[model samples]
Target: MWQGLLAFVALAAMAGCGEQNGPEAQMAQGQAPNVKIAQPLAQDVTEWDEYTGRIEAVSSVDVRARVSGYLEKVNFKAGEKVKKGDLLFLIDPKPFKAQLNYAEAELERARAKHELAKNDLERAKRLFRAKAISEEEHDARSKGLREAVAAVQSAEANVYTARLNLDYTKVRAPIDGRIGRELITEGNLVNGGGADATRLTFIVSTDPVYVYVDADERSVLKYRRLGQHIGAGQTPVRLAVADEDDFPHQGTLDYISPREDTATGTVTLRGVFPNTDDLLSPGFFARMRVRGSTPYPAILLPDRAIATDQAQRFVWVVNQDNQVEYRPVTLGAHIGQSRVIKEGVKPEEWVVIEGLQKLRPGIKVNPERLSLAAPY
Candidate 1:
């Protein structure tokens, strides 16, 4: 009876092991992994080529005195907004005023001399006509009158120049802009009107700023082929400063270099933007993008959906049988979180956006349908 019992127990243990390794148990433990899948977003999209660029003022000027003088007063506060023609600095006007006074006095003396010569010439002309004076004497008086007229004109020019010098003593802003700190303070002697002129300050126009960028030769050729010419203002551009995530500023292509730089093989391009709020400033680093292609129908997938195998980018697509298929894709520019699909994926096919690590080609998946329009 003990021998029979031992054999029966061994058989029961073998039966239990078989049940544990049965197909039902395997099916229960190894169900297909759930994945989120959605059809590619289809829209008319324009590809934007991105570039790093620098912000520049539309107009920039260095403030300097037009006349040599002792600086009397710095009219503007350091780093203030000033309008065109606003007084920026004042030079000592006493010396210029004295020179102007002397010029006026000389003009008056020249006028008196001219009158005396004119009267003498008139008397000589009458005597010569009445045969009361020699012709030589009358000619000398006429010559004196001509010399006097020239002297008077010279004096008048001197007076005008003196006035101009006096006006130059008051330095004014040449353009509307935010001014830099005063470089030369009051009581300092400032030289003017040469290469060595003292720089008083600087001003850069704030509104309608410029952004300059360099584009590769291929990009420039593409733009030309699209019928866009230099300074056409037809090509639209968007800009974002270093602190911004999105391009909030809108501008137009204003300039393109006539020749490409031989060393870099790139062409310089400029865009003009209106800065009403004064947020954009010169010398700031910014990211700018231009519309590279015309609007066309494109299939878009979230950047997360894209996977890389060596150099090839691909995504997993779910077919009508709910089996994951490997699809290689060609990508274009990125639009927000989505990438443009130049080829490979179709608009109607669903692509796996989640559970990518658990997927294999031809594997069945529990697909949860998602709307591409909704946030991923």
Candidate 2:
């Protein structure tokens, strides 16, 4: 009987202890998971739109002969910098010089004939005054003098033409630019100043180059609206050529097509950039970007904070109740370490940046708010 009473007492004590520990076990287990939260950064930022484009010279020229002749000499080295009025090529100047000399000689002979005719008219005038010559004879001498004067004028014009032909023998650069290879080498016969004129070479302006891009209708409209506040060239732009990691070149939007292409439904845009270093060249593949909008206040969060469920992007927000709630957000371009949240997220809201996996809608969390600055 004593053993049975001891066993019953021990069982009663164990049962009572177990009942007390049950509530404490449940209370202490699975405390709210600790998480880090931060308010979205409010900043004023300007967004940019990117496009792929090709570099083009501000001006390009196809050098051609202006007078038919055998090319006597090439004045410039292939791939050289040339300035306006710089002599580029010399045609067979010997022929042009001879023509000019012949014209000058003809002009001198015309002057001598004009002088003799004037002398004859004077003599005829004296004879007419003394009645030693008929009126018809005096008129004939006067007419001869006029004909000689006309011949002199014609010869003068021919001399001017000859001088121009002589100058054409020396082909000069029409613009300041970089010249390419000599297409018609020395001693080659070249046709000039007509439909069949031979091309001598090519040249293109180097500094302050242009970049052209085709922008869609939507972008065109946006740019037009932006233009209401800012001028066309006032919009900031940047460019990067092939092998460049970043847009080191700065420029501005200079031109926009008056109409869109009916077939492509896109408009052309041109940006002009200063290339003092001559690093940018014509026909180079490049990447360009234009400022999308004026600086505006925006909310930003770390990219890692945002989670995607199917196509929907969301973030876990801790409300005043210290409870996690699912919130969808509209994200914009990445700005350094943070992403712009255009909509569905407020700058003052606490967004869970870490320990996001433990979050569930309506779940309580121990939020340790942090002050995290964007790297950008």
State every prediction's TM-score relative to the real structure: 0.89, 0.80
Tell me the lDDT of candidate 1: 0.90
**Candidate 1: 10-residue stretch with minimal lDDT:** 224-233
Summarize candidate 2's per-residue lDDT along 107-160 as a digit string, tens digits: 999999999999999999999999999999999999999999999999999999
User: lDDT per model, in order?
Assistant: 0.90, 0.90
In the predicted model 2, the residue pairs found to clash are none
Name the top TM-score candidate.
1
Shift of residue 277 alpha carbon in model 2, Å: 0.2
Worst 10 residues of 2 by lDDT: 21-30
**Which runs in model 1 stand beyond 4 Å of their true positions?**
1-29, 227-231, 374-376
Report how far residue 140 has shifted in candidate 2, in Å. Answer: 3.7
TM-score of 2: 0.80
